[model samples]
Target: MANALLLALALLAQDSQTGGQAAAQGPNAPPTDEYGYVAWCYGALGGYANLYDRVMPEVTRIEKAFPGPDGVAASLKTYPELRAQAQKDLKTFASAITAAEKASPRPISEYGGAQVKRGAAIWQGADSVSKARLAQMWMSWSPPGDCEKRAKTLETKSTILGKALNFNSASATTQAPPPETPAPQPEAPAPQPAAEAAPPAPAPEPVATPKAEPAKTAPVKAAKAETKPAAKKLPPIGGNEVIVDPVNPIPCAGSLVPAKRGGRDVLICKGD
Candidate 1:
């Protein structure tokens, strides 16, 4: 009887252990306890949507006021830094949402409360900065135009913000906004008359021939012949014939004889 009682006690302990294990593994189990994170995500998303909606309408109103569509759009594109910040904020909000969804729902209520607080802080900061920028834009207006149109844009933005913050009854108080000034119309330029075709350049004048001068002839004179004296004949002498010196002989093979003494003569020398 004591052994039987011990066996029954062991079976009861086994059943309790199995039941506890099944309860722990149930489908309704919570995944995580990150309530603060979930609230931050929802608030951030709401804030971003509010900002986007507000900014876009203001931008559109400004464009309409400016009249020149391209100029207004281009001017907005110049604020790349502002646009980048907005995008970053939006992405952060989206990521937070994703993280919260993957987490346990039990923590979401607490997270939402924390997110609301954070959202309110960010909204206040952003609103102040936006107002300052708007003030600068207003200050830039010249004498003929004060920022009445820009003021209307601000009023609209405020309305959007109020709605985003869960106050749907809020409305813009700015009066009936004045219509945009029409741009000055440029005067049409006067058309110039077609120039009368210039008279064809006068036909070139006929070239005149120059008169030729008569040729001049010089007088002719006949030249007279010059008188010459008769030359004396030289007498021939047999031994007086010139003989060339051997050391200074002529290049010919025959020996030279003087045709006349004390006068020029031909000389001949023998070849080796």
Candidate 2:
């Protein structure tokens, strides 16, 4: 049963892989070929990279374990610089995807454009807090390794490879937070004079009580072994002895007597 279940799971994973990104894209979406793949990657990856730059510094400051030679203060000083490095990496990635698109046989289709718009919108519409949470969540997310490799391969290729990338973009329309109104500050009150301290109360006199009596325990009765009714005795064999089963099989008052013929031992009815 376990083996069958494992085989089924393996087949399912294989099916999902062969189905590719197109399985996620609806009928109206463009083919998930090389060009289509890169288009979606460009939007999603670019937006994610931008989001990291915007939120990572704040996220690092909020974390308890931000590493530094000195402490949190030194870490805070260095962490923001990471955002700059992230921006540089983002630039490199964007340039690669842009180049890949230019070299491709065709420009992004209408459906592909919608996907790109949705992908980018996800990051654009999100607030700093949401982006920070997303950056944290991104740490555990691992898509198929082939995704990046295939996207990289698309660069310098003139032919379109696959179908348009599609996914649920319901979260893409995250609304921007409303402007926060400033709260009015209250006026400070006048200072009051300190009061005199009170004296401590006297301790109460001790009261004596009678001592408790010792408890007496009752004796436990011993259990007696149960006695059974005696088994019936057989008649004496050949007027002298009675046939009996093997070694002390039956409870008897007589002594055992061996026989000459091949048979069970007999017991003398009378005990001396």
Candidate 3:
């Protein structure tokens, strides 16, 4: 099936089939350590871009060594050997990627090593299927198997690359600036103290009501001055005389009356 033509299809485009594709061409393969580094590049980062620059010319030269198949039956005769070399070429590519990463320290490219490794793992699984088919091809005559393993490798590779692209876009948001901070407000004024109050006055004693002292007549009081005891009022020098018992003195100051004096009646000025 499709696997029968894989080696031919997998070969890089070349000017002409000048050499066999199954071996190192004009130039030597990288040393094992450098070649093994591709496994790490496959694991930790994506394959190296410079790998094509280093190996494509050699790959092209190697493919030219194996001329045209002209037909599938004719091509199948050498494809198994070529397929084995294809596996080695994959390893060589992995090593080159790792070597490039070490020499140049390309962190960004190496970042996809995880994906490269995963794709390599799938490619390894496909190679296992290819190995089984290679054994069957030599054991007995049978049609070539379908490239199911390679199909799976392509599907997984697509998934990994899609995730890588999405990750790059999402990482861009982190580069933008953060939001601005707000300013503080001023405080309010403090309160003042209040004034003190005054104390009350003492109560006074109550006044008593005097008994009704009748209003005294000023003229009547003057008329009674003749009897007021300032100085004894003298009897008037002339007055009508009346005989009055001595015991009964004249009722008025001017009244003359007879009074028994020394056991005899005597006419006397009563209260003169």
Per-residue lDDT for 257 in model 1?
Answer: 45
Q: Which regions in candidate 2 have their CA more than 4 angstroms from the true location?
A: 1-31, 65-112, 128-135, 138-144, 159-272
Per-residue lDDT of 110-167 in model 3, one digit per residue for the tens? 3435445533331232233443333332222111111123323433554565566567
Q: What is the overall TM-score of model 3 with all chains considered together?
A: 0.20
- Model 2 weakest 10-residue run by lDDT: 159-168
Model 3: CA > 4 A from native: 1-73, 106-112, 121-272
RMSD of 1: 30.3
Q: Model 2 over residues 9-93: C-alpha lDDT tens digits?
A: 2332343365444324422222366555545545544554555556665566455455545766665565456446445544544
Total clashes for model 2: 12
lDDT of each: 0.41, 0.48, 0.38
lDDT of 1 by residue, 1-272 (tens): 33332232233233235532322232221122233333333343355445544556565566556646468767666444445654555454445444443333234445456555553332333443454343333222111111122223433543455355433323344355689999999999999999999999999999998878777777666666664444322333355433453334433445554332355553423233
TM-score versus the correct structure, for each prediction: 0.22, 0.33, 0.20
Off by over 4 Å in 1: 1-45, 53-71, 77-102, 124-272
In candidate 1 the C-alpha lDDT for residue 138 amounts to: 28
Q: Clash number for every model?
A: 5, 12, 19
lDDT of 3 at 23: 15
